[model samples]
Target: MSMWSFILLLISVQCVFGTSSDADETLSVMEDDSVTLHADVSAIKREDQILWRFGPENSRIAEIYKQNMPTYDINERFVDRLEMSIQTGSLTIKNIGIQHSGLYKVTIISNGGTSEKRFRVIVCARLPIPNITRDSSQCSSSSYCSLLCSVVNVSAVTLSWYKGNSLLSSISVSDLSISLSLPLEVEYQENNIYSCVINNPITNQTTHLNITQLCQPCADTTRCGSAEAVIRLVVSVVVGVATVAVLVDHFRSVSDTSPLVP
Candidate 1:
């Protein structure tokens, strides 16, 4: 093989062995939020410059130059979402979304030579509050009660049910969805506790459920007695009113017959 081709082959072998000469950092940001990627160019001089690229294919995203004529140019892919600092050569993304998440590579020109800094960006959407509702149709007072955990506007989120620290059931969804749900059933008891949790890497929400509150039986005997007493009182009042009406009708009929004789 030619010298240049042999050199290229050696570089490929090193990459396959996970020894690529690129320096990279990992960054995680929440969706619709802003994050700053530090370049550590504190010693950057007026003669130095910086070039920022994104994605696996290294698409041009932004450029900062302090050479003969200082200027900043951001590509159309980022549009109004990118900002560059002249002093530190740091870049910030504003209101980032999923499409803006990926590998970001920057090439910096210094007195030593051209070096690179890579950032693996992860963008997560904030999780919504999960609804922990009792499934009334499936619950039984003598046994267990079923509860459903659900959320809307979910992306890259996991919904789970936990009894203390032990996980009972979980569902992970990476794609965006209008609704996601998971169900769990547990025996009814006064001290039983269950929690429904939904989370991403950055944020989470949890709601608790208690079996006693959700799976209670019908009205107790105490309330039943009061209900029966009210029914009896209403019946007695109706019968008394009927008896008075009958006596009034009989008196009127007798008076009508005697009036003709008088």
Candidate 2:
């Protein structure tokens, strides 16, 4: 072959091999909380091997599949949770938790060359129990009797108001605090049970409030008198108990001293 022809042939061969080595590999997280690793390996004609690694730098090998066989060496935390199928080169991670959130790398090796792809895994926290309370106003008829629902230490807030499991209204806010105005049209009896559901994409929490409508004439006088009587009785009992204890201690001390005379 001529020198130019030989050179051209060598370049063509390198180009073919290079193109074949660059297989399109991608990683995705499925709806079932499984991490899927897929690659188009049709270009490579040899026996290709697939390896899966996880973590920030892909320093840990979660599983290995080569020549249509499976070998797993996952971390203790992911012993039964990590699974991979070699035939389709797919990895399924079950029951993903906060600890499992990180980067996953898939490496494909064959006679042509080696290629890799990376994907990020994210896990959200369990939602907290929401706190719902009546902010102010002693009477239900008062216009300022507002209800507040607070979700502490929560992010990506989605706050919703409900009455007996039926959704009344929903609001989305960037912060955890959400204030909902009680509908004046709603009967006072119907306002007794109000529930607030706080949620994010991954977790949900709820709380409830019971606002009893106050009968001003009955509640103010009757409740105040009853509460005062109860408070006085409690104080008298506590004082009586304290006096008895003191007397008993004093008698016991005196008896101990007299016994020393023996």
Candidate 3:
């Protein structure tokens, strides 16, 4: 056989007897949440054995074997917070933390043969609803207004500004903190609306700003506040004049009824 034909046959043989793993399988969970990684096995025979491994080096995490009856064992890293099913070959991790994010591999061996599947887990805390606060000191219609987007109890996140579906500005940080902020400035206009979005792999939050509400000419003249006060002053003056006229009429009536002294 030619060298090219020999290489093609070798590739087909590897495809038939490979470790049989998938890399794109993904699972996401929030910190302090519980998650289960499926083994994709339906049933297991009495002689079948299952091994679950984690990390890049494939450190053994848990296993199920049939020494006498169905037996289960887990490494010290996951001894107290893991559950493995012998029948379905599923692994459940409880109270998962951000440190638990990694690659997981499960190998199932039975009378048929050995098959393996892999999963990539991502665990992160969900950021709270982001707040949009206008910086009036830097805000004006002649130039631009500075807006601040922030959230508490979150770190290692991304904050961004979006006008409709298009991205305007974004910031990302690797360090952690209790609060994070992203500042952006846009020209003052009453026709467009902007949004502040904070996101992570697991979740996201967003808030919106209406330009009409922020512009000076539009907000200050929303039917005008001083105009309403002027109307009230005019109403009070008319009421006071009517009241004085009634009191004068009452006094004159009393004076005419009084008897004159000789």
Candidate 4:
């Protein structure tokens, strides 16, 4: 091969590998929210052709040529959910869900050569409010109050308990949508504030603990309810017996006062 031809072959190989080295942008959005992937270009040039692809298959999802109108694929997975910017060739996914979370790429073709951008998207579920409840088993302790901060059907989040802006305890879940609980024990007479928080990468929800209401001794309410029920049952039995005895005595008296006619 000629030296010039060999040099051209090496340049072609470099270009092919250079396109694969584009840095991927990591982005996170809450489920059912919209996310936009920017092209980072100030404006689309007249001679540029923009193409957007998604997932491991790199399926073509949207495209725009020159100053012409943009077009989107009719694939059911992305139907009515894809939008592209005419000014900058940015792509927007509306009402994004977990299924839509994956790799996305945009290729710009022009006289200058080909350039690419990649995005790694993650759609996290909305975080549930952390629940603060007194642990019944620990309620027997006279000095300390056992409490739990919990959240259910959550993934990629951290459940934490805080005391006056300081973290007391925390638990986290990665990929599985499951339950998480963190326990904290505080003095019954503690005047410090407490809260439970559940958070994902996108957002967080918190619940404040009412120490006076939840941390009370379990005996205060459970035993009282039991005693009241027993008292009601005993009173009802006694009234029933008294009524039966009185009725029998009245019938006997009537029989004795009746005339002794044959």
Candidate 5:
């Protein structure tokens, strides 16, 4: 074979087999957003054939041939969500969802040879704001307040507690959608800033804690002084009313027993 012919044969062999594993690109996108699997070619030639396969099954999902219009699989799995760029052979998935997260491969075939590209897509759910609540079971203590930071129906995320810029505690889940909670203990009068955060690879949400507001009822402290003051005020009013009633009754009895007034 001639030198040019040998080069063409080698290129064709690589394309037929597929791209190298290290060439696989990883993309992360939030649910309901669009993701484009780039062909990485400068342009698509008129006689080139573009094909795309998806998932571990390598199911053919889209194709374009010889300057003809692109077509997508009629499978309900894709429906109207797939689009292709005729000029570049890149594929775009609109309003992507968690079910669509998987491997994707694109092959471009031409008279000279062929080229291939692979991609791994990760679709993540929106992160919910972490909640910070006082752990009531630990409320009996006066020196410190027990708190919990939590989130529900989350996957591939980490829940964390931070004191100012410092991390206090964290818990993570990889694939399962479940609830997560991290506990923290702080003095009732803690002046340092505290916050709870929940995050995935793409995004994060945080909630700040107000120590005085959440731990205000802890026992034997000024944090409980307002409630105690109210109780004391009520008792004093009741005793004063009883004393006035007794004095009025005693004066009434004396008047009834003494000389009559004009």
Candidate 6:
């Protein structure tokens, strides 16, 4: 064979051998607050080595392993947070933020050949806590109070209004701010509590809102009388103490001057 044909044959043989061991190996990732990647190469050749790379395009190397040995070279953003176990072929990343979402590549190499697999890592955003506030003046006997539901830290969300355990209404929008006005259809008394729930599908996060009825003027005559009495008693005690002090001083002065005559 010519020299070029000989080289081509060698390359084709290597490619075939490289993919032969990949049939039994598998890789998967589970994500929560962090990411856990499990790679099983136990069925592959015993002398094979594993390498891990991570990035948007999988152009950077995050870690490497060979024969139960490991060489970690992670980016600056994942210095102390990224970890790998060579024996298990597992990678655990802590505090997985939005920036960490991307593609990851794992390469297995042996003296005979090499094979590669790719996994996608997805990092979710934390959901915002919903704030519910009511406007009392806007509410009348004909109209129920207006409750505002606001969320921070997220731009898009779905807001749901719940009365007790039942869902009242749901509104979805790209903006973070939303409000729902309750209608005075029934005998809605003061101190009624409502809830607003926000959901973010991307991050799989849900938050709740607690809404309370607006404050009203108290109309209990007995309680108001008792409060007034207490205030009067306090003022009387203060005045009585001042008067006694003045009388005692006057008496002391008179007694001190009249004592010589006695």
Best by TM-score: 4
TM-score of each: 0.66, 0.51, 0.58, 0.74, 0.73, 0.56
Point out the worst 10-residue segment of candidate 6 by lDDT: 14-23
RMSD to native, candidate 1? 10.6
Q: After superposition, how far is residue 202 of candidate 5 from its true place, in Å?
A: 1.7
Candidate order by TM-score, highest to lowest? 4, 5, 1, 3, 6, 2
- The global Cα lDDT (0 to 1) of model 2 is 0.57
On the 0 to 100 scale, the lDDT of residue 88 in model 4 is 92
Tell me the whole-model lDDT of each prediction, alpha carbons only: 0.72, 0.57, 0.72, 0.80, 0.81, 0.55
Reference-based lDDT, residue 219, model 1: 40
Candidate 3 colliding pairs: none
Q: Per-residue lDDT of 58-127 in model 5, one digit per residue for the tens?
A: 8999999987889999878788999999888899999987677668999989987987888967677788
Q: After superposition, how far is residue 210 of candidate 4 from its true place, in Å?
A: 0.7
Q: What are the runs in model 1 whose C-alpha is more than 4 Å off?
A: 1-23, 67-77, 175-178, 210-213, 218-262
Candidate 1: how many backbone clashes? Answer: 0
| Per-residue accuracy of model 6 over 1-262 as CA lDDT, tens digit each | 7754453343333222322232333222223376767665654345767778776455545445345556667467667777776566667778765455556677777786777776655443455666655554455434344556556544335667776678777766543223432322223354444566765444333334332334232245677789999999999999999999999999999988884544
lDDT of candidate 2 over 213-259, digit per residue (tens): 42122235566889999999999999999999999999999988884
Error of 4 at 216 (Å): 2.0
TM-score of model 2 (CA atoms): 0.51
Error of 2 at 137 (Å): 8.4
Better of 3 and 6 by lDDT: 3
lDDT ranking from best candidate downward:
5, 4, 1, 3, 2, 6
Model 2: per-residue Cα lDDT at residue 119: 60
lDDT of 3 at 91: 91
lDDT of 4 by residue, 97-164 (tens): 76786679999998889999898776666777888888887676367889888888765677888888
